[model samples]
Target: MTLPSALLLAAVVATLWIAARSWTLPAFPGRTDFVLMQLSAAWWSTAVAIESIVPDPADKLLWAEMAWLGIVCTPSLWAFFLWSYTRGELPERWRLALVTIGLATWAVALTNDAHHLFYTAVRPVNAEPGAALVYSHGLLFYVVTIYIYAFMVMSIVVTASGIHRATPAYRTHYLGFLVVMAVPWAANAGYVFGNLTLFDLDPTAFSFLMMDGIFYWLITRRRLFDLLPVARDALLDAVPDPVLVLDGDGTVVEANPAAQALAGDHAAIGRRLADLPGLSALSTMVAAKPATVSGPLTLDCGGSPRCFEVTWVPLTAGGGGREVGCLLMLRDVTHRHRAEMRLEDTVRRLDLARLEAEERLVAEQEAKRALNGFLSMAAHEFKTPLAIIDGAAQLLLMDAEVKAPGMLPRLEKIRRAVRRQINILETCLADDRLSDPAFALRRDRLELPVLLRAAASAQGDAAPGRRIELELDGCPARMTGDGPMLELCVHNLLNNALKYSPAGTPVRLHAWSERGPDGQSHLAQSHLALSVADQGIGIPDSERERVFDRFFRASNTGTAAGSGVGLNMVRRIAALHGGTVTVDSRLGGGSVFTLRIPLCEEAPCEDRMAGMPAD
Candidate 1:
């Protein structure tokens, strides 16, 4: 075989073999453009091989024109593939424009009959048995040549710029790509300069076979196009997370600024994770041999304990068939960890406080129940004996004149004492009933003024020496409530006024009614007020609220002979009627206790003034 024919056959075989081998390797960065560039080189080789041996000059010219298709497209394809192999992505518009320009130049070269812009003239070979046809160039041919050279030069420049910045394995791969691209470029240069004239061969086609084998070896063995290096200065230093890259033997190969800061004063690169002072916890995690582990880990780092979320990621090669190294990333989680701990402590304390409060509440409720039982039992027990004594005194009073003159008066005093004792017992019993939650209001339509008058009369009868003046004037007669409860409430108030005042001092029991004094009405209910005013020792303002609490009496009451439940029962009775009892008093002046009930309807106005009666 002639030298040019032999080279062309070898070129075709090598290009085809590499294009096929590309499929077997795992998909990598530039596999698409690599396959296409190889295929185009193969096509060009086949056309060149046919053109070299063809007997007819016309057939050779046709094949030479066919071969131009690969010549025009191969460099641009290599340019794009190199860009994608080194950098990450190519802009779609740039890739498309490149392919369009390449195909346009190929079209011009093919349709040279119309324009003659690609080749000024085509001449047949001065044949030595296996000589290839050569063409004279036109303006467009040089333009296309320069265009092809620009693309190849750009591919070389892109690869060369990244070599120093690339990691060791990546630098070797980039150098290999540059060398393979340079083969065809140098061969074409030699041919153009008339330096490679052996047997009239186009050396560019011969160089394709050399390029194919180099690329195939680079891809399968070196993994040249698998991963590319990013701009380390921009990405690594600016990232907030600490990142460390280690080699196969666990030596730190790269450390970002964050990683350096985390490692303290010492440099981290070239040191093993086990040797790092601040990364003891991280070293232990790496030693555990887990494929991936991530969680909170604490490091003392020569100061207060710092917390980090540590991640262990093992780097792999050959689709995880080989272990390259591991990546140790640490992110500061101290603030988050402290906040979570504080929240946990707060929740724990609140839980303890809540349990204590619940226990106290249970104890208080038990004490209240015990007090109520004692009061109920005492009242019942006291009432039975008081009734018997009251009956005996009444019988003795009727027959006292028959015994002695002094015995009659003594029996009368005994009757009054028994009646007072009975009143006290009744007050205690009322307190016990009011304390019960099940005691519901049994409402009835009754004349409230009549109830108040009866209560005043009863009080005067109970304490004959203490005068109580009844004033039911201007009060609403009709009201809805439990008549007995309201009567008892009024009687308690009258008794309080009489007991607190001096003997012979007038205790004023007054009743009145009102429509809407304030807008604070529920369902537009009206109000009926019964006030007990005393010209006796008065209450202080501070003691008013507490006076209505169960078994609570004012401090100014001063050893008064009384059960404390009388006013409390009055307050409860008022609440049952959806009303309130309020007090007005001074230290020297006597006090007024007012029981105001909510009437179901607006009361009819009486033709009387609102002020109290004069002495």
Candidate 2:
């Protein structure tokens, strides 16, 4: 083959090699288009090489016409290749338009003998050696050339656009892409518009083949396809948070879809940060140029207020890692912000309620002190008058013979009434002391039967005719407790029983040494049981629990002279001794009030129980 045809064949082989290598590469954006572009260049060179070798002018013209297949496809496919490879993807309509133009150009060029719109005439320049055919120009030829040049220009423009956006490492690769676009475009432009040729043949295929070397270097050495525009798109578009990449001047450089939604009606890209009112605070903070800072930021989104946690980090680049811009990420925290506000409101309300409760407690305590003082003073002052009345009633018994027989009983009744009043006053005083904070159970060794017998005797004197029964079958002769409190407890129980029951009815008092659970009298397992049983107005079932409350009385206790405090005071004394007071009775039946106090608080039950013998 002549050197010219040999060069054309070499270009074809190189382009085919590039296509074969690109075909084996892992698929990425525009990889198919790139491989097709190389194949088209190879086909174009093959057809041109045939035209260079053929002898007859008719044969050369036929080959030249056949070459239009690859010639028409090459430039348009190169433009498409660059669009998919760097611009991420070419729109379908543009791709279809490129394809239609290529197929229509091939059809028109093939039928030039009839329409002659592509070439008016075709003839061989030299068939001897290093020569090929030339075609006379037609209107469609320049039109097609212009459009092909337009495709290359678009590819160059689109590829160059990304050089600024790419990192320093990839920016070199983008420049390499621009070189790839310019090679065939410049060669073809020179041949068509400037009458340029390489060895009497078009130099477009030769330059295009040389471009394959640069593309190979970019793919293999520069790792071109690894960092595709598609990856950048997927990463930025997938983020749910508003991501804004700003220049050092706080002008918006790049904003994803989320940022667009957040900006609402405002056009984001190319706009200054101050242009967005919702992002003004973030813009100011970005102006300060902090390395990293995050806080609450509120934004108006579609007329509804939404809160976000705006985070700013300086986007640094290059070997020096100098700040290029700030990446503002606004994470939605509306739900969290509103919840915090509600929690703060609840805490404030709780604090106010606590203050009100404390104030009420203090006021109630003062009122209680005043009421107790009045009762104590009143009790003290009336005792003298009560004593005088009791003495006068007794003295009238001495003069019973001077009066009617009924007068003696009437005087006796007056004395009994006065005694009951004095007992009531004494109960009031005991209740007052029980309520005192300083009041403590004065535990001392005492006789259980002796205590009960004395309490029984005191009640008997006050009632005149009521029988006070005492049963100390298993009672310990010695016990440990406050003598006055225990005696007072018994007196209060007996007093309540006698006052509520019929005047002729008798009340029973029982005391025993009782064992706790499992019949073991060790540790807290044992207690002393004292119960007062009286056939009186019994408590209703519903009010049984409340009967021990201070100032609480049974429903059946109608017209019964009671301060409603004696039983409450008894319960208080029992509790102070680490025990409880319980009642068991049915309505209209007698009630049994039992007080159980632990006998082993300080020591073992065996020691406290051994102190007394059976009574």
Candidate 3:
């Protein structure tokens, strides 16, 4: 065989092998049609190659018939392949019809010799032995040629439509298919109409071999049949989060619909991220480090500031861990960011308020300590002078009584005045000591009537003109409590009663002990109530509750020479004994101050003030 013929035969063999291999590939859209089209191409190339080197006209005609059989089937198979490739599968009926038509055309061509329909006359073009045959016009040949031309036009339309619909990445593959298919059509047209011949053989077979090679190259190198572009489009385009595919240099290679909108109106492919206003910060981050996922990146998107969490995904080549590209995903986090800012602001305000309150509390406590120290020092100083006056008054009273019996009452008044002053000083000293929480109560069993008599006698001595009386009504004879504090509490009440009441009015001390509901209502318990009743100026309704507050003086105690701490101290002492003090008064009708203490259980005590100390 000649070298050219040998090469052509080898090409034909390779085409057949490729067609067989393509048919065995896993099924996908247009898979069967692709295999059928390739097989038709192989068949045509084989017959044409065989016809080229044959010597007999009859043998050439037989080979030409075989070649024509493949030729007639080629366009229909190609059309079906486009239908499946572009539109994802033809209807079953449409596929069947195309197959039937191709088979019928081949049958008609087989009997063409009887009627002179396919070829009117046939002869070799070179008039040399082992040269390819040439054909003259026949009716059947023209009819089949027109049918094939229609399919060719339809395949072109299908491929063009496919290219239009393809992604930017896959459009080149569809264009390659169109260009390869056109090569055979162009070769066929030149041989039939323009009389262009190559090496005394039809060039259509060579074009078919070239087209098959292109198909194999496109499928292998470009992965044209994998349909990954479709998958990439379906998943990435439909996602709401902005996604970007970047090359190793951080240039944007592909962007989805959301990313395009985020980047503003422009083409994104092949553009560097730094060129975009919203994504420039991301570009800077990626440039610094190949892969990093840090977020809450703020950007102005379409004139509105929004927060987004950015994720940087490294795209590696296969499993080799070689860095190839990157993927950026941005998720919106505006609401969460705003909420965090608000919470931080709220915490700042609360911290300021807490600090201010702490400062105020510290100042108040310091002032109270200063006031308590002043009271303690002043009471101690007054006691010294008060003791001297009381001793001098007693000595004068005795000397006056002995030397002049007529001056006895007047000197006795001087002694009572000194005693009253001493009593007031003692009250201040007791109040200072009671301010200390660690000061223990002095508990003892003492009769309420006896304490009441003693308090009345002291007040009667202080105010000689005032009538003092003791009224005892079923009062307990004895109870356990702090005797000195109780005596001070009663003495203060008696002083107020005698001091405020008119000189001739009666000041009554009423005492009672009874089984009744404790003020706190803890079952029935024994109680002793010591009341100091006087017909004096009374407390008003408004200041009733505040009468027991420290340093609170009644409004209507007109020009009354008294310290305001009396009632407050009384209330404190009563509370220390698990008791309470209250008042019932009317304007101009006078007031009754009552101290009720719960009685303690019977116990033997050697000392009168067992639980209390004099200090």
Candidate 4:
């Protein structure tokens, strides 16, 4: 055998060896392109071998083999180039179509030769010195040759363009494949142009064999066979749970069949880990440690809930090199986790029930103690008012100055003080009754502006000299609630505003009707937002949230007497009416307390307002 033939035989043998060996190795990068290129090169070598052996100048078998070889190798070469160019992103349909077309062409060519329609005869002869070979040319033979060259050129151009568009990581391998493909392509062009003949030197076939050798070297250097075998086995294997491995850069370097199955058939490999759903926490866990760690993870896999116990271990290169990637092993633990959670929930409920029983017992005892303390405080509060009444009455009876200039005013002050004290006691008793748990709202439709006016009038009567202004804008809207309870809430808010604000500051009470989002007619029915703004020393920022708690008061508002239950009562009443009370206040800058209530349901009006109540 000559040097070229010897090289061809070696290349063919190596191609078969790698194809067989690739089934066993762990799948790694660049393996599929390597395998496909090997097969194409092997077929090309078989054609070259046949051409060298056949002595006939116009041998039909020799021409048929060349045409069949071109048909088989052309698509395979294109596919390999595509895989190299795209880094394996070429769609499966494109590859299948190419292969199908090549095989159909081969079948037609083979049938034509068998029927003697394309080539008629064969003859053997010595052609030239040291170039003992056969050659053939016919109408169909030259036509197929032209088609093959044209197709190869087109495939190469497309492959080259795809290669240029590839990412930087795969560009080197694509460029190398391009050069290898270019050599055979250029050699064939030279032969066609008569610059070189098959008898003189088959440099194209020799160069092709060299390209195949270079491909083998590159493949073995990167252990590309490893990737092919892993991919094949993963497709064949059946594992229970999703499993994947990630490189140090957090790209999914490998995934098993089960992993792909769980990930919804999406391509898992060569994609960044962060791009995958429900994998962010796993990535974070692995990155934080960069060492072996195992824990439970809850994930929404698509729309279905899944739980996993994932173990992550760092992967190291050979010779004790630093860590390069992580090997993730996932085991489905959804059933186990749910079982454990159910048992824990059962125990927690039992504990909570027992704690609640204890709390109820303690609450009853505290209520009894509170009642006793309240009675003592009530007696003291009543004694002062009773003493003032007794003193005023005795003065009126004994003094002839009862009709003096300021005598009547002093007596009225005494009476007002007694009335205020009585009102406080009555309010406290009502509040206690409302807290009895059996209390529920006796809801009814009532005009909101009328309620506001009544509340403002009562506050003005209580604080005789304080100016309480009412700004009733638009028609009076109505709301559904216990009229007495709502009145109490409005009364308390206005009272607190007047008590806290400086005397002579205009206490503005406003009422209005407005629309809401729900398009229903809230006729005379709207958010009766009664805002009692005070130009008083407002509640401080730190104490704003606590102001609604019973008995809570701002320490900075010195000597300002209050029971501190007014705002708390307002909140409870708002909650009862399915509404809420909010305070916008600044220390030393006054406050606006808004009571938002849904309009009463049955109030008559000419036009119905359209909107939902503001909360």
Candidate 5:
């Protein structure tokens, strides 16, 4: 045997050895093993066919047998790889089909030797000095080449599609295998097509050898076959709760299939822990300390509310050194936590109920004491006024001089004082009348600015020494409401302003139509605003909020003689008219009290018929 024959025999032996190993290799030996085997077989067959066509008759039958074996094995190996990868299932029908195809191809090649169809003849050539070679081709030879090329393309497509369908975990393994498979297939096609001409340098055999190394490395290093058990164990372990391994920065470094099942079907790896519900707070807690906390947590998995007892512990080495990350174990504690919270709430409510009962008892006792004191004070006030009226009437009746003009004036003064005292008593007794449901409003229309002017006039007349001013900026339009009540609101505001302000300072009653942001004029048709401002000792900031409360008195008013009910009454009347009264005041800078009212159009006719004074 020549050197070529020896090399061919060695290549064929290597191909068979690698093929047998691939059947049970631990990891994907990649396409390199199959591709190398195919190339070796093809090389042997083509060499034998060429050698058979030569004039040399020695070993012609052996070369023909070798060529036939190569032809049969190449497609058989290619078909096995294609079937295993693409379909992911190996059925008896597919195996039988592959066997039948291989036998048919081998039989056709054998028949070509007798009938000169597959390969017509072989011609020996000495193109290069001291080199012997033969070239052979036939009709069936070209047809087989076409079939092989078509099958190679189909294999590439199927393998690539299968790789694409694989999970991300297995993608790298499959892709590496694809590269190993593709290289030799491409080299074989190049060789068959005469595109490659490297003497004694068989790319097919080299590719297979490279693929064998790849498969060995994959099996030893990647441990692809071990993944199934690991994945199964991970799923079984994660079935109880959401199990996750987080990096220091709060990213999900690893998660099992169960974690995915609980959280979401989306890829969780490398996603920021903060992005997941309930997990973000865990990150914060871990940063602070290793402790357990139970709370209500929401998860995006299904927007389900879960209660979790989150346990955080630092991962430590044998020497008590801190590891790079910490383990977070979450246990569903919703029912338990909720029950505890409900118990706490029940205790708090019971305590509050007990305290409220105590407060009510104390308040009842206080009310009794305050009623006793109020009655005594009321009796003393009533007795003094009654005694003065009695004494004045007795003096008038006892002396004829009491009937004189000076005596009558003193008598009138006594009468006025008694009336004032009676009014105070009436106000106190009728306080509950304000809350009466049947306290109907006597509505009417009156010019607001004119009424304001009249109230200012009356205030000035009552205190002639004080100067008052009226700054009526808008139309003196009529508004509907109870004229007397509206006038009383104006009067009380003016009185409070005068009583608090210094003498000789201007007391201004201002009315205006203002446009608001809603593009509606406040006093255009339905609403009116009137302001009574005083240049007096303004209310203190602390007391401003309570100024409208009944019996609320400011400390700095310096014993100004007036009931604190004026502003309260003003607020009540404004509210009755579907309006509100607000105060804008600063201490020592005087106060601006604004009354907003819903206008009544029919107030003028009613006021005129009732002989009521109009503004």
Candidate 6:
């Protein structure tokens, strides 16, 4: 039996168990990459374990190549994990460069047939079971080994460098990390240079089991910095934004340099909130204890006054979760405030009320036109990148069919993603434009039956294969709304149902008038309800609330082309009518979008806009 192979498998299992436990930790400080490291090591161990006992030379060679995927990444991931753990961040460029070199190294190892730069030769026959694959290391293999050790040494040096400045609690954690990150590489180096082997197998993979054990102890017993506060020097102090924390009694327990400078009290700690005259307006909100943003609190900083908006939230602790303190973040809004003041002064200097009103109206109209044009132009600009990607994919498609057949479907997926983006671009822009106040609602009396029937018929015509059933017999004949906007809403809703649901499915369009709760129209304002129900892929329960939010698509709507803004546009239109829109949906069962609008009741007036003077 291959005892080394069994131990290697045990290493794989133990590492994966730790990886599972690590998932519950917070995201940053290399927590994500830490789990990735474990998973990568687990696979490497599994491959090496299998390679030890496999009888066929071809099979052994395949597993050896597979192991290189994890091997090439050993140093880079270690360096990144240590840096992120100690410093809380690694620059994106460094991460990209490391990953690129690692993957390129793996690729060279993978296709060693063409160049043989990674391994000069590989075979199964020169050794017994439970032994390393028979292979002659090439120049590139040693080069990559040096590359790995470079990162190993660099990580140890960088982590230890910060030890003096780190708090006493974190300095020990730093030392522990340097040990945990370097052990496997140390074993790998020993195996290559000093012939350290377990039952004729490389000891590198087996060392991970010991590394995982130490990593677990560091996290649970020694209190690794994953859950600790931001590193005082790199983050809390270096940030330009002012931050302050107070105890329950309003004593300033902590204040960053920016916060102290903003308050003009270098020694703000231990001072009560009431004593800080700069925070008088903020002090009043403490009794209320609401987590909210308030006030442009003006601070007289040595004659140069600065205005700040306070965003505060209650910080609670202990068993009963009693309010322990509050954290305050101050954002300087002096420039915006000064701009407003300047605009007000300019307005006051203007001639007369009538001229001001005329000028304001003209300015608003011009701004609206310019804004709409800009949004459209910006949306189109996004297509330039997408088009470039699509063209590249198209060129690769012909090449991929011959050289890399497996990549054909991936290229097709990219093409599909590009086309979907194009389809949704206009709707996204249109929904974005809806937020402008200049896109005013012009409500007019509308015949409900005529309007709804026209919409359903048009949608049905466009998608000729499906049935759009209209239930409008009980609906009241008249309502008030923006005619074009209402038509747009109906079209959007209908389009979503048809697009998401399977072809030839019947989509029910129901509209009816609801009498007052007392069964008298005069007692309360009468209302009308309209619904579109489709038996298509329904919205997931978690996402139902956000389905009408701009650019939110249901997770289940896969590969069905859709502009996520359709429902959001419907909601905006509904709001303009002084009504509400909501969805009732279930996964695989379909969705019902209900839009309820208040019906006009006073004297059943016709289109009032016809006789009313324009603003």
Candidate 3 lDDT over residue span 1-615, tens digit each = 555567677887787787777665444567677777777777777787777667789987877777776787777887887777666677778767877877776677667688878889887767567766678869777888898889989999988887876657567878898999899899889988987766767787788778878867986664333322222544677799998888777678678878888888756666889988877878877877634546488877878888988888886543356676788888988999999999999999999999998998899878877888887888788878878877887887778777878887877877787787778778877887777766777667776677778777877787777788877867787788778888999898898888777778898887877666654565677788788898988889898878888778889887888768898888878777777799998877899999887787643222322343232
TM-score, predicted candidate 6 vs. hidden true structure: 0.40
TM-score of each: 0.60, 0.62, 0.50, 0.40, 0.36, 0.40
User: Relative to the unseen true structure, what is the Cα RMSD of model 6?
Assistant: 36.9
In model 4, state the lDDT of residue 342: 100
lDDT of 1 by residue, 1-615 (tens): 456777777768767877877755555656677777887787787887787778777787778778887887777877877777656667778767866776776677778888888777766566554346667877887787898889889988987987766655356766887778788888988877665744676778668667778767875564332321333545666789998877666677677878877789877776887788876567767777644555578887668798888777776656555666777778889999999999999999999999999999999989989988898898899888888998888888777767666787677778778877777777777767755766666657897766776777667767877777777678887887778778888878887888788887898887777666664665455688778889888887788667777677788878887657777787767766667789888776898888888777433222111231211
TM-score of 2: 0.62
Candidate with the greatest TM-score versus the true structure: 2
lDDT, residue 384, model 5? 77
* Cα lDDT for residue 299, candidate 3: 78
Candidate 3 displacement at residue 532 in angstroms = 2.3
Each prediction's whole-model lDDT (CA): 0.74, 0.76, 0.77, 0.65, 0.61, 0.74
Candidate 5: worst 10 consecutive residues by lDDT? Answer: 606-615
RMSD of 5: 16.5
Clashing pairs in 1: none
lDDT of 2 by residue, 355-412 (tens): 9999999999899899998999999898999999999888888888476666887887
Candidate 3 is scored at a TM of 0.50
Runs of candidate 1 with Cα error greater than 4 angstroms are 1-4, 20-31, 55-58, 91-94, 111-127, 132-136, 164-169, 197-200, 222-332, 356-451, 457-488, 491-571, 575-615
Q: Candidate 5: where is the Cα deviation over 4 Å?
A: 1-65, 127-132, 166-170, 195-221, 228-615
Residue-wise C-alpha lDDT for candidate 4, range 1-615, written one tens digit per residue: 555556667767876786666544444443554466566656766666655655454452555455465445554554445444334445567656656656775676666656654455544444453344334445665765676676566657755765655434345655776777787778777865665644444456656656666755655553333222222232324566677767768887667667766666456767787777756557777767734545577776778888888877676654445576777878899999899999999999999999999999899979876985687578667767687785775577456364564576666666567666765765675577556556667757777677777777767866888898788876356666788877888778777788788878878776665554453863443566667788888988999988888878887868877878877877777766656689999999889998776664643221111222221
| lDDT of each residue in 165-188, candidate 5, tens digit only | 554655676677678667767776
Better of 1 and 6 by TM-score: 1
